[model samples]
Structures are given as C-alpha cells and as structure tokens.
Target: MLPRGRRRARGPRPHLLPADARHPTGRGRADGRAGLPRRRHAAAAGRGSAPRGGRAGARAAGPRSREGRRRRAVSDFARVASAADVPAGAARVVNVGGRSIALCHVEGDAIYAIDNVCTHDDGPLGDGTLHADRVECPLHGALFD
Candidate 1:
C-alpha cells in the first residue's frame, strides 16, 4: 500500500539507552522537556579538556646527544703575503687565519691559496677574475675552478 512517493524501510534502531544516556541534569525528554540540541552541553562547555601530552605533546624533539659532532679545521699553514706582497701574475686578498685567502701568483714560483669567499654568494674573491688557477665569480659569473 505504498507507491506515491515511496516510504517503508525502517532497518536499523536498537540502541535503548546505554551509550552515556544524557538529558538528566535539569531533566528534559519524555515530554517534561527543555530545548534539546544542547550539543553535548555545548561541546563540553566549548571544548575544555584534552591537553595532557596526547600526540607526544605535539612533537618536536630530536638531536639529543653527540652535541652535534664538532669539526672545524681549516688552517694548513697561512701567512699570506710576504714574498714581496704579490706582483708577478697578480692576485692578493689575504686575510689568512681568519680566512678569505686568495693570494695568487699562479706562475713564477707559484702561490695559489684559494677561498677568498664566493663559493657562489659570499662574492668577493678579491673581486674575481684571476684566470690561471681560476676565480671569476664577481657576483654571479661563477667560475671558481
């Protein structure tokens, strides 16, 4: 006896009060009623509990040992410029122990030191462009052989 708009399929119900019943404090349902849709007491009074270290206190804690290995050793012997302050093929931006040591002579007696900056961006390999042992990078030409 149903065909107009079709309506007859009540298939799942049995949940007779056991899942935290509710509707108690200030008694409602069964008709004596209060508004209804309190939404679990307004979602437990607007989201209250649950901050105890759930997802491991929301992650972020590694590198706890070995202190970070420690290794910084670049010295090899640096006085920089003494053999008459560089003049033969020219190239001299010496700082030495503090680093920034280019000091090139590249030919007679040979004096190449390298590393005056500009491994790409530090860009001051004594302004760059030595040629023999290679330098170039005056802020983006980037040769550095």
Candidate 2:
C-alpha cells in the first residue's frame, strides 16, 4: 500500500457470468453444447427412448430410403492402391473416380479412406499425421476418424 503519494494501478475489471449461464462441465455452453445447434433427438431431452438402429427411426422404408435394408453387394468400390502404398501409420492421397480421398493406414492390417478435405476448415486432410484410425488436421489441429 502507498502511504500518501500513490495508488495501485488497476487492470481490466473482471467479468462474471450468471450461475445458470455457466456450463456444468465448464467446457461448453450452459446447454452443454459446443457452440453447435441442439439436435432434436428425443433421447437427448430424456423424453423418449432412443431409436434402435435395427429400427433406425431416422428414415422411412421407401425406394429413396434404406432405413433397414442391406445392400446387395459392395463390389462397386474401385481398388485405387495396395496396402503397401499406404504403409503402417501413414496416409496416402489417391484419386478414386474424380474425388480426392485419404487412405489412412492403421496398424498393419487395417486401412481406412475418407475425403481428403478437412471437415472443419477444408485443409488437406491427406497431409496430416495419422494415429490409429484418426488423423490430425495439419492446418487447424482438428481430428477426424
């Protein structure tokens, strides 16, 4: 404390939020969403039972929908590269038809492919680092599986 000639310099005032406005987990909005619009899933609100995937209430049975159907075959996938091309714990960007896809090699026997563009910022997903089944975006650190 200054006795007579000086007072302490003060910084910016601290801001406070209402108790109800604070998230219970202290990581997101008060509603527990990470800044995304709330989904209307009944189970989320504890109002109704979650739909069974075998029931898969997401769509109705119709020509345009396959809510509870099985495909005849998965023979349409084109073989773009061999597992050797994407080694273990690495990624290889390849063109299938006309789309740029990233083939992530996990362990030694599993390989997963996804769009080469990052879902968060459209960065090059293929150029990112690979860990198990997930990839870290090179541009913004977003992780995708």
Candidate 3:
C-alpha cells in the first residue's frame, strides 16, 4: 500500500506547462514536423482571435459596449394615465416615461403593468382586445389572457 500522503504509481504526471512555455520560440517540434502547436496556430489563423469568431472575441473583450452604455443612459419610462382613469375589468394603454405600458385592472382593484408589446410579435397590446384579466395581441390573434 502507498503512504497516506502519496498517490498510487500512475504513469507520468500530466504536463501543466502553458502553451507559450511548451513552444518558447512559438515554433513546432524539433524534427521539423508539424505538431499539435502548429495545428493550434492554423486554427487561430482560421478563427482570427483566441476567442474564435467575432462574437466570441467581443465577449472576451468584457461587458458594456458603447451602444449598451448609451441605451442604459436613455430613460425608457413614460407617465401613463392615472390609476383612477383605468376602469375595472379592463385595461388601458398608457405611455409612461418613454415606454408603452399595458395597464391592467385585475381583481381586488389592483393595477398590473406589462410591456405593451406582445410576446408573439411587436404588435401593440393597447390596440388589442382585452378580456377579463389578459389582453390578446391584435396582429396575429395571440391571446395573453
């Protein structure tokens, strides 16, 4: 049996050298034959960056691109009609901040706010038909009720 701190004799330990360390000169094997490292170089050449495609490279470059920053800064809210304006058992389309909101009057005199756009498409929920609790998308007749 092996010692408590030692593992069983299991062949050679796996090589943990970095890619650059494995190829100090960034070249192939000594025999002038192409090796795995050469294949990696060819793959990199084909894919461009280390992350592979354009999307992968962008992801590796970190978060919050310029456009994303601009979007975050832009206010998307719009003030819709008042709570008293909405009737019971119905919904009203109101522009709040800068976004369209589907103001729904559910049971217990509660107001529910949902995106005016339908999940099926970009159809405006405000122009759609409203049932007891949900609104149906008017474009394709997709029911959200």
Candidate 4:
C-alpha cells in the first residue's frame, strides 16, 4: 500500500571536467596570472579598436596602479553643491566629470573633496561616520584622512 502521492526519480550526475580542461594554463589563478584571453575583448574580436595612451600607459592605468598614469587637470569645474549643503563635520556625495566624489566640510571654511569609495573594500565612503578630520567606513571601519 503506497501513499497517494507522485514521486520523481533521481537524475544522473553531470560530467566533471578534467583539471587541465578547467584551467587551460598549468598556472592556475593562484599563480598571479596577469594576461587574459584576447578573444574575450571586442578589440581582439576586431569589433572595437585597441585602448589609447599606448601599451605602457594602458597597463599602468589598471585599478591597482591608477596613479602611475599621469592625467592633466580639468580646467572646467562643475559646481556640484553649495558649501552650506555640507556642514562642518558632515559629508555629501556628488557626481562630477562622471565620477562619484565625497565632499567633506572640515572646521572653518575649509572643504575637502575626495573619492567616495573606500580604498580597503571599495565601499561607499559617503555613508561613513565623519570624525574631526577623517571619515570612517561603515562596513569595515576603515578610516580615511
């Protein structure tokens, strides 16, 4: 006597790929691989053109070493917000030149502008706690002076 319910059979396990097939190169990602398959990019596929600033500058402009690539100052400055909007010991987030910036107002009339991202975990520094002369990240408690 079986219960009045339907049952399903188990399916076969999927095939597993070999270690060499999983990582085409013997040196896995643990070995600090730098190069990527050109086919993955549109430039390599002939759909788009290569990067500008030459190879040396392009390589140095990565997320790890952005300061290595020199950039000219922007002559034009877009007024993001008024100084009164960000009171002293407080911060405000603004967008300028297609970038997220943190506008912090220190003591007196001195105001500081910095990237809104935390360097430790790339978290939003705009939502951090503002101290006397530093901003502390809410996620990992990393302070930015």
Candidate 5:
C-alpha cells in the first residue's frame, strides 16, 4: 500500500540559449578557459554602413587640438522639462544628445544642469542624494557642486 500526491517532472528543461552556444571559442570570460562564440555588433557587421558614433568632423584631425572647435556654438538644445517638473531640492535625469544630464532645482527660480556622471568613479550622479547646490555620488561618497 502506497500514498502518493503531486510529483515533480523528471525531464529536460528549455533554456534561453540555443544548443550551438556550447561550441568552444578558444577563450573564456574572466578566466583562461573555454569561452562561447562572440556575437558581431550590428554597427560593424556591414562594410557599406556607417560606423557607430557617426563620422567625426571633417576638420577634426591634426592641429593644436581644437581651440577652434569652440568657434562653432551649440545651436541645438533639447528641452527636457519645465520649471515645475523639477521641484526645489530635487533632481531629474534627462538624456540629451545621447548624454545623461542631471537637472537640479536649487532654492527657487534657479535650475542647474550638469553631466549625470560622477568624476571619481563614473557613477550615476542623478541617482545620488541632493544637498543644497551639490550632488553626492551614490556609489561612493564623492560630492559635486
């Protein structure tokens, strides 16, 4: 006499990767062992296509390293939010021209914008704490004003 209820399935399970991923690539990640095949990036897959960050400026080669580049004023500015969106003592992160910018509302009627990357460790500054007119990096205790 035996009493049995629900039983677990004793079979193979499906995973996210395909079966071909098991092939060796003569290298491994973080160790000197076998590694999976590397996938080609879409931007560099074709010869007829442009490169990833688009072509650099035509005059961006050879010189005193571009004091003249500043002659071209930035003519494009994207509006991320209005004054009311970021209240006082608050910070908002916005992407402008593929760069992360932190908009901080300080005191009243004044808004400051800075790159949302910490200089010390490249941490996200927008996710950090806001104090008066400075931002503290979340990863470390680095502060920016």
Candidate 6:
C-alpha cells in the first residue's frame, strides 16, 4: 500500500464507452468512446444546439456571425444617475438586470461600470476601495478593471 498522500498507479484508461449508457444520440460517454450515433436538436433550441456547420465551422464564420460583436453592439444604455451623484474617485452600486453593478467615477471625470461581485469569490466589489481605474475587492483584495 502507498502512503496516505500517495496515489496508486493505474493502467491505461479504456477507450470504449459502455454500450448501455444514455446520452444524446451519437455522443460518447465519459470514456470518450462513441456509444451511439449523435442526434441533432431542433434549431429553436437556442445556444445549446450546434451552430450551423458545427463548432469548427463557427470558428470560420468570423465576427459577423451571431453572438459576435455585432450582437453585443445592440445594447442601449440607460442613465442610472446624474454625473454628480458619484463624486470623483468614488463608486456606487447600482442594481440593473437583477445584478449589482459598481459604477465608478475616477479623477478624469471618466465613468466605468463593472459587476459588483468579485471574480475571486463573489465578494461585493462595491464595498472595496476604488483606486485610479481599478476596484479592489474588500474580501480578497482582488483587483478588477
């Protein structure tokens, strides 16, 4: 037997999936072996469905394809507060789309908006210190631009 922290050596993994496993048609099991023929979902199934000629084809579709920069450019901005509401070098948490956003105003009279949750551990970013153009999360001191 090996020591408590040591791992046991194992042989090469099996290449074939179990024949009876249930998954989308033609998809492989956890073993990476194809169990059955893969099936295609309806076009209206949205994002989860394969895009046209599959993932490889989507890469060649360019930025003009759906879900690209063109789709992101359609966002319309709504005024959350007056410029003076957030003084220079200050930040305020604004609730939008059911999520808290940290609206920051820096020295250059420039305003920036970012998620209020820290990427580190979902800590509230609005409660953190506002530096020049970054916000430091209070819980972990993780910096976000």
Global lDDT scores for all candidate models: 0.63, 0.77, 0.68, 0.73, 0.72, 0.74
Q: Which of candidates 2 and 4 reaches a greater TM-score?
A: 2
What CA root-mean-square deviation does each model show from the true structure?
23.3, 10.5, 14.5, 13.8, 14.2, 9.4
- Please, what are the lDDT tens digits per residue for candidate 2 over residues 1-145? 5535696557744437644556767556665444444558876675565465455444444334255464444576889998778888888999988899999998757999999999789999999998777999999999998
Give the per-residue lDDT digits (tens) of candidate 3, residues 14-38: 5665454455574554334433344
Tens digit per residue, CA lDDT, model 5, 1-145: 2225565555755544444454445233333323434547744454434544666343344233346434533466667899989988888999988999999887656889999999889999888888878888999988898
The candidate that achieves the highest lDDT relative to the unseen native structure = 2
The all-Cα superposition gives candidate 2 an RMSD in Å to the true structure of: 10.5
In model 4, where is the ten-residue run with the lowest total lDDT? 29-38
Q: In model 2, which runs have C-alpha deviations exceeding 4 angstroms?
A: 1-69, 73-75
Instruction: Tell me how candidate 4 scores on lDDT.
Output: 0.73
- Candidate 5: stretches off by over 4 Å: 1-76
Error of 4 at 43 (Å): 36
Candidate 1 wrong stretches, greater than 4 Å: 1-79, 84-87, 90-95, 104-115, 123-128, 131-139, 142-145
**Where does the lowest 10-residue lDDT sum fall in candidate 6?**
28-37
> What lDDT tens digits, residue by residue, belong to model 6 across residues 1-145?
7536697557754535454554555454434544443556644345454565557355544456454653334455767888888888889999886878889897789989999998779998888888889988999888999
Ordered list by lDDT, greatest first? 2, 6, 4, 5, 3, 1
Quote the RMSD, in angstroms, for model 1.
23.3
Q: Pick by TM-score: which candidate is best?
A: 2
Global local distance difference test of model 3: 0.68
TM-score (all chains, Cα) for each model: 0.21, 0.54, 0.40, 0.47, 0.47, 0.50
Q: Give the alpha carbon lDDT tens digit for every residue of 1-145 in model 4.
A: 3335654435744435444344456544523333433257766565555455456345445444355645654565678889889988888999988889999887666778889999989989888888877888988999898
Error of 6 at 51 (Å): 15
Report the lDDT tens digits of candidate 1 across residue range 4-39: 669754675554554345355534443343433345
Task: Score residue 24 of candidate 1 by CA lDDT.
Answer: 55
Clashing pairs in 2: none
Q: Model 1 misses residue 124 by how many Å?
A: 7.4
Full candidate order by TM-score, most accurate first: 2, 6, 5, 4, 3, 1
lDDT for position 31 in model 6: 44
Which regions of candidate 4 fall more than 4 Å away from where they truly are? 1-76
